[model samples]
Structure formats: C-alpha cells, structure tokens
Target: MSAVDEIVREWTAQLLDSGSVAALVAGLVALALVLHRATWLPLRGVVTIAHEGGHALVALLSGRTLNGIRLHSDTSGLTVSTGKPTGPGMVLTLFAGYPAVSLLGLGGAWLVTVDLAHVMLWGCVALLAAVLLAVRNVYGVLSVLVTGGAVFAVSWFATPAWQALCGALLCWFLLFGGVRPIAELRRKRSHGRAASSDADQLARLTGVPAGLWLACWFLIALVCLVFGARWLLLMPQL
Candidate 1:
C-alpha cells in the first residue's frame, strides 16, 4: 500500500480495536484523581489551557484580534482579544470556557475513533506552542511549557499502547471534570459572590440572567459528559 493508504489502514485498525477492560480501568482511576479537588492540583493547568483556548478560538472566529492568553498557577486563565465589545462574538467568547474542555475532550475522542491518538498528542504540542507565543507572564509560559513538553515526550518516547491509554484517560478526565467548575460557579452565584464570573458578564452584556447561562452550561456539560462516555468507552464495545 502507498503511504497514505497505509496510514488509513492503521487508523482503521485502531478505530476497530476493542480496547481492553484494563485500559478502561486505568482511565477510571485517572478520572477519579482528575476530578478530585486535592488530587487535581497538578493537572488543573491542562483544564485552564482548554478554557483559555476556547476563548481564543471564538475571539478569532468572531473577527477579533487575539491579544494573548494567560494560564495561571491557580488554575484560572484569561484570554484577551480586541474586537467589538458588544455582539455575538463577545457572547460566544464568554460562553466558550465552560464548554471548551468538554468539547476538546470530545474532539480527542473523535480522533481516537479515527485512530489518530498520536495526532491528538501532537496537536496538543502544536497548540501549546502557539499559546506560548502569546503568553506574556512567567506562570503562563511555565504552564504551556510543562504541558507541551509532557505531551511531546509521550508522542516521541511512548509506545502506541501507552499513547492510546493516555489519550483516552485525558479525554475522559476533561469530559467528567468539565462539570466541576460549573457547579462551583453555581455555588458562587448562590452565595451572592462571583459577581464577575463569565455567566454574570454574559448577563450584563445580553440582559439574560446569570443563572440561566449557568443552567444552560450545566445542561451542555452534562450532555457532553454522557455522550463522551458512550463515544469514548462504550461504543468501542459494540
């Protein structure tokens, strides 16, 4: 077979490969740690990367010039853009964070379905590199470097099986972990704090209630979580 044909064949094999129960178990363990507040300390930055990346993507799509994206040590991120402050673009940019991580995980699952786990890892490397160019602060730079480096390491040194396992676990974590922040946002809103959250910001910009935005996000995240579980795990069984 030609090179392209060979790649397609390999991809087909991976897509059809019924992953072992051990692999599923591994992902479950990782999911637990990724979801746990205390154990998620180190991996929190990855979630922030997805959050800020979502904002950056919508900003670009909405005809804004992305000024930069910052990832903080505290797992908070900011994406700055220059554009019309009031419009669909701004609303989408604001709405991107909560859904971004789950969407990203869904995208990753799609890649695995197409037998492109290595592509997923390499894609992370490339994206982090781009984010690095826009990073202005020490923490942001460090965060991008660490994440990019680890992914690059796996892509370069790990076996295919290891890469596949890591990819699945990462996808599961993002799908499951995406809801935690939304719950926290709801709690903060209920407590009369977090007056400056994205949902509240959207409410100010669009005249909708912040709770409604939160509710919408909650529903979307829950859906993504359920569908992602089936797509990444259960579907392969059938």
Candidate 2:
C-alpha cells in the first residue's frame, strides 16, 4: 500500500483500539503527574492558559476591547479588557475563567471517547496559537509557545500510538487538573484570603457571597470530572 494509505490504516486501527496498553499506561502517568505537586507546577500553566483565554474570548465577544493576557509563574493569570464596567459583558467575562478549563478538559476527553484524539491535540495547538496573539508578557508568550510547540511536535512527528498516548495524557490532565484551581478557590475563601480572586470579583459584581461563587465553580468542575471519567475510563471497559 502507499504511504498515505498505510498511515490512514494505522490511524483507523488506533481509533478502534482505545483500550490499548499504551493508553492505559499513559493515563496512569498523567494521573501521577497531576497528583504530584512537583509535576503540577509546570503543567498548571495549561489551566491558566485556558482560564485567561476564556476571559479574553468573552471580552472580545461581548463588545469589549481586548487588552492583553499575563501568565505568571505562580500559575495565576490575568486578562485585562475594556468594556462596560457593569453588565452582562462584565459578568460573563468574569465568569468565564474557572469553567473554561473544566469545559476544555471535558471536551478533550469527549473527543478521545469518539476516537478523535489527533483532532483534539491539534485543536489545542490551534487554541494556543489563538491565545498567543493576546499574550503581552514574556512568560505568557513562552508558556503558549512551549505548550503549543510540544503539542504540534507530537501531532506532526509522533507515531499514531505515541500521538494517542499524548492525547490521552493531555485529556486526563485537562480533566483532572482543571479541578485544582477550584479547590484553591475554596481554600482561599475559607481562610479569608485573596479577596481579589475571581470569586471575590464575582461577589462584588453581583452582590453574591464569594463562597457561593466558589461552590458554583466547584460544582461545575466536579460535574465535568465525573462525566469525563465515565467517558474516558468506564465506557472503554464496557
């Protein structure tokens, strides 16, 4: 068979066999990385990227002028936009960050469930590329470039098995890792810390308690995790 035909055959086989040993091992490794603080430090930037991208996306969509995004070393990001100081646009822009990561994770896992792992990886690359355009800080630029480059490398050069492995790992990371920030938000709220957090901002904007916002964010993350686990793990076993 021709090279193109052989590659297509290989991809088809990989798609049909999501229960492969490689996928299982990759998932375990991903879980370990997400659970360990040392590994989480570097990878946390991925969540931040999604969070800030969400803010930027909503800002532009809501008739706001996009300022820029800043990704800090502490795994925190800031997105600055100019718009009506109060209204649906402001509230939506503020509301976008936490759920963005969870939704991205859930979407990625769903793609893998449907055997579209490669599509998810390249889609991430596309997302990072789009986010990079709004990054105004050195760290933000580097974070997007490095993450996008790694994903691009895998999508472009890796074997189908390895690509699938990378895709699964990323899906798991996005699925599980997205929940951490919500936990952190809860901790902050309990300890009366970070009064300027997103939850706090939401509180001030809507006159709702920050704790309620935290609970809402936690619920969204938990729901995403449950559904993602079902799709990624339980469905495959059945």
Give stretches of model 1 more than 4 Å off. Answer: 1-20, 234-238
* lDDT for position 172 in model 2: 75
lDDT of 2 by residue, 1-238 (tens): 8999999989766654655544555667877988899999989999899999989998999999999999998889999999789898998999999999888988987887776778988999999999999999998899999999999999999875566667777877877777888887787767888889988888899999888888888889899988876666632411
Against the true structure, what is each candidate's TM-score? 0.87, 0.87
lDDT of each: 0.81, 0.83
Task: Report each candidate's C-alpha RMSD, comma-separated, in the order given.
Answer: 7.5, 5.7
Error of 1 at 114 (Å): 3.0
Q: List model 1 lDDT by residue over 1-238, tens digit each.
A: 6999999888656643656453466468767877677888778788888888888888898899999987778788888899899999999999998899888888887776456889988987888887788887899998889889888998999877668767777788788778888888899888998989999999999999998999898888888877766666643421
Position 66, candidate 1: lDDT: 95
